[model samples]
Target: MRLAMGFALITLFCSNSYADGYKLHPGTPTFQGKHFDIDIQEHCQEGEVTCPDVSYDSINKKTGARLHLKGRVMFNPNNYNFQGYIFDNGDYSYVLNPNHSKGTESVQIWNLNVFYKDKVIAFDEGIMQ
Candidate 1:
């Protein structure tokens, strides 16, 4: 019942979201993790027109470091079943991979791996709904 209400609120918040790019106001639907808390909003770009890209604001709980990584809704053939909302910068990356569809949630599971050069420095998984 609670999950359904959450999904309903998610639906209400996400309805008609792409008219001027993805705009998640105030970040109610957030990725809650132990070491990181991430939220997303519409990526504001310079120019006359609005961008359809999305940006993630991630905060490291331990160090209080924040990252404003920008990316878009990527569609990969291999990851067709998942939400390919992915971001990468040099050796650092944030990928929102899928777990399994419990119902109709877009961001149900998260898989993030922070890389330092070639090795992964941190890995965290959490729920987003």
Candidate 2:
């Protein structure tokens, strides 16, 4: 019960941030995970805040296996749902969660548990964007 509440709070803080800061269109990350690091690149209309057609680039930190994927920026304004990016690439489903900090530094958190086909692939974090 306590853990659930804590997770809920964390989710609220992370997802509460607006997309105004993190504009994808060829977005890049300084660090990559052991398995891969996801990027929010291209497929956004000019002058639009949210995008439906989004592209993602991933590269394995160890083997350097780059995974190119495509997804969309989705959300439910009426229901206050996950306002982030998602990819449905067959067996590998990805939710590029918007985990940003709302402090003076004002950066995005890249804590990820990368999994491929129900197998633990790698872990990624320590990204400020």
Candidate 3:
């Protein structure tokens, strides 16, 4: 009985920790046949006040070139749900959950942007408008 209780406690703790991590799974979008795999994680570091880390990874399908992007993101105090990132590349930025008209519509669309060289490489969840 004691072992079972311990296991239950451990499970709860793990789930709680995971709940604090907000992740966005950007759908696969290829550029010039070079597939981009993105894994965006917004989680707090050991000494960070909140989830200030915004990072992503991309792998080239043809040449196997992997690009890892790291950025510092800020959270809005009035709206804790909104966050944005500016990557170390200096030309790239990603805004998460931007305020949009569609967001208030029935569909509840989520807006995510990927910029390169100050130009938007990819934007919006579905079709770009």
Task: Give the top-scoring candidate (lDDT).
Answer: 1
Q: For candidate 2, what's the RMSD?
A: 15.4
Q: What is the lDDT of every predicted structure here?
A: 0.64, 0.59, 0.52
> What TM-score against the true fold does each predicted structure earn?
0.55, 0.55, 0.41
lDDT of 1 by residue, 21-65 (tens): 433345654776666778866565654133448788876655556
> lDDT tens digits, residues 35-77, model 3?
3334555456654534546675644433345666776666667
User: Which ten-residue region of model 1 has the weakest summed lDDT?
Assistant: 16-25
Give the runs in model 1 whose Cα sits over 4 Å from its true position.
1-29, 42-52, 78-82, 101-107, 116-119
Model 1: pairs clashing at backbone N, Cα or C within 3 Å: none
Q: Tell me model 3's lDDT, rounded to 2 decimals.
A: 0.52
lDDT score for residue 21 of model 2: 31
**1-129 per-residue lDDT for model 2 (tens digits):** 999999999877665343223332355564343345556664767745457688777655444455677877767768646466666678766665555553245555555545678665645564535
Instruction: Report how far off residue 37 is in candidate 3 (Å).
Output: 4.0
The list of candidate 2 runs beyond 4 A from truth reads 1-35, 47-50, 79-82, 100-104, 113-123
Alpha-carbon shift of residue 13 in model 2 (angstroms)? 41
